[model samples]
Target: MRLFAWAALAACICAAPTLAAPQISALGTPAAPTAAASDPQAAAAVRVAMRQETLPPGGSLPEHRQSGERYLYVVAGRLKVSNLVTGEEQVVEAGKMAAEQPGDWHVAVALGAQAATFYVIDRGPADGAATTAANNDGN
Candidate 1:
């Protein structure tokens, strides 16, 4: 009886804040994706959750590879993405979206005064190893 009464009181208190604080927007949320929705290559397995990354003014790229394709949407500022696949480099500004296909060699440098933020939705790696941290994770 005591436990039940205490539980009811706790629930009531928890529910009381349902109408108080307003919702604040987060810059980005990165998680593993599910299902091979739009990518033709990822039609066979579940995709990983989307990833959101914010690169500072001097942010550089690491060597990594992913099995699924990448769809990157720039959320803030501008960036210079170099495609080493064909010796190509391009500038991607804010409000623009770009796709980096599988096995493409590239590097991204922040082109703005502050930081450049972007969100990427793509398939996860076939193996559990994270390529982004390949060189820096241990450091």
Candidate 2:
């Protein structure tokens, strides 16, 4: 019985598809212009960091600015992000992403009655802070 089981498992494993090279799948198409197009210094090498954050219903992040570019992907629920400089506001839902250029002042708040979970990727100068509080006058 053990030998038969081992043979069956081996056969199943052998029948599974194998990849000859890495496969790439795009998440979604960007609706707005990319940050790289406007930032001339984007090509410079920078430090990168990733983190996951969850906000309870109605939770909010204080207005702040990133020393580097920030990319946020919503894992669950909806998040409302407001850009102080551009006066643009957007709601990013699950499976959607938002990007913030360096020095762009913004704030985010969880929407709906459920907790919102998301992943953040920050890319900035090697010695710069990830985020800092925005000026009171939105400078």
Candidate 3:
């Protein structure tokens, strides 16, 4: 009877579903596409994009730039952001936020032992990439 009970417990444990790990997710479409701003004289509506990302400890997003404005909010852990152009650095902690200007080159890294999770809201051309890699030559 005891052997049967142990086997049943093992089977139940093995059959349990595994939890999925959290990951970055980008949702929805941009409100205005870059092409929509083709007319220089026309007032174009800005596009908005939102995404959530998780950076492993010591991991980093390389030097990059966005075509529009970006706002970052740290959800968990700590984030170290550096401006490649100006050589300025800022540490954003959980519950804190930071802003990035259009065409600004910057890099973000996860600080400390724990991974960091953050949300990004970007406003720019509707169809533009969230970020573009910048030339590494201190340019």
> TM-score: which candidate is best?
2
lDDT per residue (tens digit) for residues 27-87 in model 3? 1122233332344322233355566789999999767787665667788899998766667
- Give the Cα error of residue 26 in candidate 1, in Å: 28
TM-score of each model, in listed order:
0.55, 0.62, 0.62
Q: Tell how far residue 72 is off in model 3, in angstroms.
A: 0.9
Error of 2 at 89 (Å): 0.7
Candidate 3 accuracy as lDDT: 0.61
* Clashes per candidate, residues 3 or more apart or on different chains: 6, 0, 1
Q: lDDT for each of the candidates? A: 0.51, 0.62, 0.61
Off-target runs (Cα >4 Å) in candidate 1 are 1-44, 124-139
* Per-model root-mean-square deviation over C-alphas: 14.6, 12.8, 16.0
The residue-level lDDT of candidate 2 at 74 comes to: 82
Please rank every candidate by TM-score, starting with the best.
2, 3, 1
**lDDT rank, highest first?**
2, 3, 1
How does candidate 2 fare on TM-score?
Answer: 0.62
Model 2: residue 87 alpha-carbon error in angstroms:
1.1
